[model samples]
Target: MSDVIVVGAGLAGLCCARELADHGLDVLVLERGDAPGGRLRTDEVNGFLLDRGFQVLLTAYPEARRALDYERLGLRPFYAGALVRHHGGFARVADPLRHPLGAARNLRAGPGSLVDKLRVARLRRRLSRASLNEVLEAPQVSMAEALRLEGFSREIVDGFFRPYLGGIFLDPALETSSRLFAYVFKLFAQGEAALPAAGMQAIPRQLAESLPKGAVRLAATVEAVDRGGVTLAGGERLEAGAVVVATDGPEAARLTGAVETPAARATTCMYFSAERSPLGEPILVLDGEGRGPVNDLCVPSDVAPSYAPPGAALISATILGIPPLDDDGLEAVVLEQLRRWFGAQVDGWRRLAVYRIPFALPAQPPAVLALPQRPVRLRDGLFVCGDHRDTASIQGAMVSGRRAAAALRGSDSGPSCAL
Candidate 1:
């Protein structure tokens, strides 16, 4: 029997287990998957490292800053803005403060009126001054409503925010909470959006490695959870002083007998190999026309050379929802779309992989966004934590994990880092 059992070796479970083990508690982490990363997984196909779905880490996360070593991760940064394809042409948009002289020029020539650009700057300044919790706990509304109320014209909402923010939030309709929108906006303002040079899976591996030897047990599936302990799939039951259900929302509900967990947002990402990159800049390319399945595109090798072998380039395209077309048909459609923007060089791009995640993120609408997020200490010895319990982000997963560990030790203070 262990002092504490963490059922899942994802970022949440690893963080919580590390917290407990550091306090001299015997922590055992069980994972059904062979690897520790849940959705943050990466695989080598031929010579390319492809993440499960397209994802980026924000350096501004308070929990990440507190718990992780950035230098060790070898963080790689993307450009401050994007190249948006609109009206059969590509236009650039960058934050004026970040790019200084050039962003204003792009804003003047891109989509959205001068008034819309001014309102965006004003909103950025207002949110940057607020505390992290203040922004999170603020009253929530739909992103579409927030943009409209902020005095941005519909043209800006559709051409800019819909495709740009929608790619980040995984909601093309902008139905996510304004609170999350503002929080992400502030993060973008404060720090760079980056990826670990090794791949996204490197994050979970680093977190799990900090624990004592034998702390993590892979291929161990928890069939059920009770007050006593968890029952493994092979029929053996391991008792513990406490059990932290750190699985995703659906699996957590299944183990703990909880009902009505939130639904997940879906996403599809396709990886491609090319002779040469269509765009050389490291900025994300957005489909401002919104006339096709492609939402946003990027080349990992453009940002970090390690993602692909020395000579080849790797490109990734993200689609927010599952469409009716099959994988082959979808690729055909996307290739035709790219041909228009980057000329016929796109015809040579080879399909490397396609990843469709139906449960990419927990849905964070207005009500869920407004709910006070804290670790669920089911009882004195029972607890649960995941991105579902917090803000539905990498930060939320690690933060919830740390909070669950604190609850086990009867401490209310989770992380000391302040944003």
Candidate 2:
């Protein structure tokens, strides 16, 4: 019998198990999927690595820095700032603070006014310097309200914040808590947005590799989890010293029968293989108009050439709403829009995949933000953790897992549990 049983082999479950195992505890991780990485999985198609969605890791995340080995991931970084598409041209908004530039040129031509850029920089500085507790517990408000309170003009809000940050949080209205905005804003400001050369799955694979031999058991569907232990799909109960439910919010609720899962954010990601590169750099392309089906676009191969086969480019477009058409129909619609942005050259791009994720992230409002995120400690030996329990980012997921391990350590002293 294992000392600890963790349900879900995603980053949270994997990280929690790693922590427990590191402390000399026998940890058993059960995952329903054939492989790990609940939402962060990757697929290989025709020699191209396609992530489940457009996801990137910010190196500034404390948990990520402490838990992950970035060097081994062969990190590929995107160009600083953004490539905002407004009317018929692209606007560049490089980090003036980090990458020194011709201030006059960028101020007059970037997404927002000079004052707006300065305000963004100031907030970014504060986020990078502030303590986690101080930021999370700071007075809260809607992200929109917070931006207005900071005196951001309508131009900057619409051009940069609306499409850019809106796409990130899946909240175009900016109804998310100001604290979340602050946390994300800090990440972007302080660190480069990047992906592993191998794919997002590499992160989880590394975590699982750190565990003991046969520590993780995939294809083990968990029906429920309680103080006693976890029950498999066939009503097989695997009793253990403690149990941790680290699945997504909805699945967690189903297994525990106690959590009221919050509303979730949805998105549609479409991938296309182009004959040639559209944009030169791996910069994020956003629709400032706020009406097109494309919320944001990126050519992953521009930064990490390995994402696509030689001489080909991979274009990923993320839409805020699900497209109401079949794969062929949706592909046609996406290509039509791409032609507008890149001209007639887009005619040669081939559609690769269309992933519409309904539960991309948890809808975190002020109330959800105020809740204490941790082991949750359902009873004496049961607990829960995931990005849903905290912020909806790789950082949050890993941090919540660490919190669960801490709770497990505190609840009982280290020792082997009798079978």
Candidate 3:
């Protein structure tokens, strides 16, 4: 029997197993998927890389900086700001600090007034000065309310913040917690949003590769879990001294019955291959006018050349929620929207894939942020950890895993049993 068995091979499970193994404990990780990364999976179609959904890594994530080797990942960064599709054309909104001249030039060209732009600068300054903990500990409220409290104009909220941040939280209504909003805003200000040249899966692949040989078992589904051990789907029982349930929120709640299952936020991402990118820069495009289903769009090949073959560009379009339409119908609507934004040139883009993720993220409202870091220790010899246990981001998942490992180490003197 191993010293511990971590059920799930996502970021949380992998990190938990890594910590335990590093501390001289024998850890075994069982993953249901054929590979690691969980929701961070990627696929290649027609010489293009398509992430499971539109996701990015914030370089300023404290846990990420501690856990990931950014050098090895070969991180590619997006531009500091986004292009807002406004009245009949696209308007640029560059980060004032990074592109001071561009920001000044576009002061009246984009979504909001000059005062609204100044307010953005002030908000950035205030959040940048505050620590991560301070940001999370701030007053709990809906994100919309928080923006209102910051004195931002409705024009800015609708045209820029809605499409930009809504794409992040999958909450176009901006009903997510203010704490998360503040924390994410601080991170964006402090660092760049990047992607691995190889793909997001490179992150979990790196973590899994660091573990001892045979430490993680792919295609190993755990049908049941107990303090002593876990039962595989084939009825084979594996024993361990402790068990960590690190699956997604719903699965964790199902196995442990000790976790609160957060409501899921759905999303759909479509990938297209084009001879050339509509926007030749590595910046994100936002649907500021809220005119169509495409909430945000980007050319991954622009950010990372490796994402597409030479002479080809990979475009990713993100829809906030799952629309009640078949794949063909969805594609038609998305294509129509794109044509409106980029003209007849959009017709040359070929559809690659459409990923409908019903559980892209766990919904984070004010109540969820009341306790940013939920308890990872369910009881002696049992633990639970995932993004749902903390903030819903890569940082939260890894941090929860580390916390679970720490909790397990603290209970080392407890009675030994198969986990």
Best by lDDT: 3
lDDT of each residue in 1-419, candidate 2, tens digit only: 78999999999899899988888999999999988888999999998899998889888887888899999999999887778887678787777776667344577675677789888778877787986666777899989999999999998999889998889888888989998888777777778899899988999999999899999999999987777688899999899999999999998888887777879888899999987789978789988867677889999999899899998999889988676888888778777777788899888888899999999998888888876363356778888888887788888888788778877889444211100
Whole-model lDDT per candidate: 0.87, 0.84, 0.92
| Candidate 2 lDDT score at position 233 | 96
Model 3, 60-91: lDDT tens digits are 98888988999999999999999999997999
Q: Please give the lDDT score at residue 358 for candidate 2.
A: 90
Scored against the true structure, residue 103 in model 1 reaches a CA lDDT of 79
| TM-score against truth, every candidate | 0.97, 0.95, 0.97
lDDT, model 2, position 166: 85
Q: Show pairs that collide, candidate 1.
A: none
1 or 2, greater by TM-score: 1
- Inter-residue clash pairs, candidate 2: none
lDDT of 3 at 362: 97
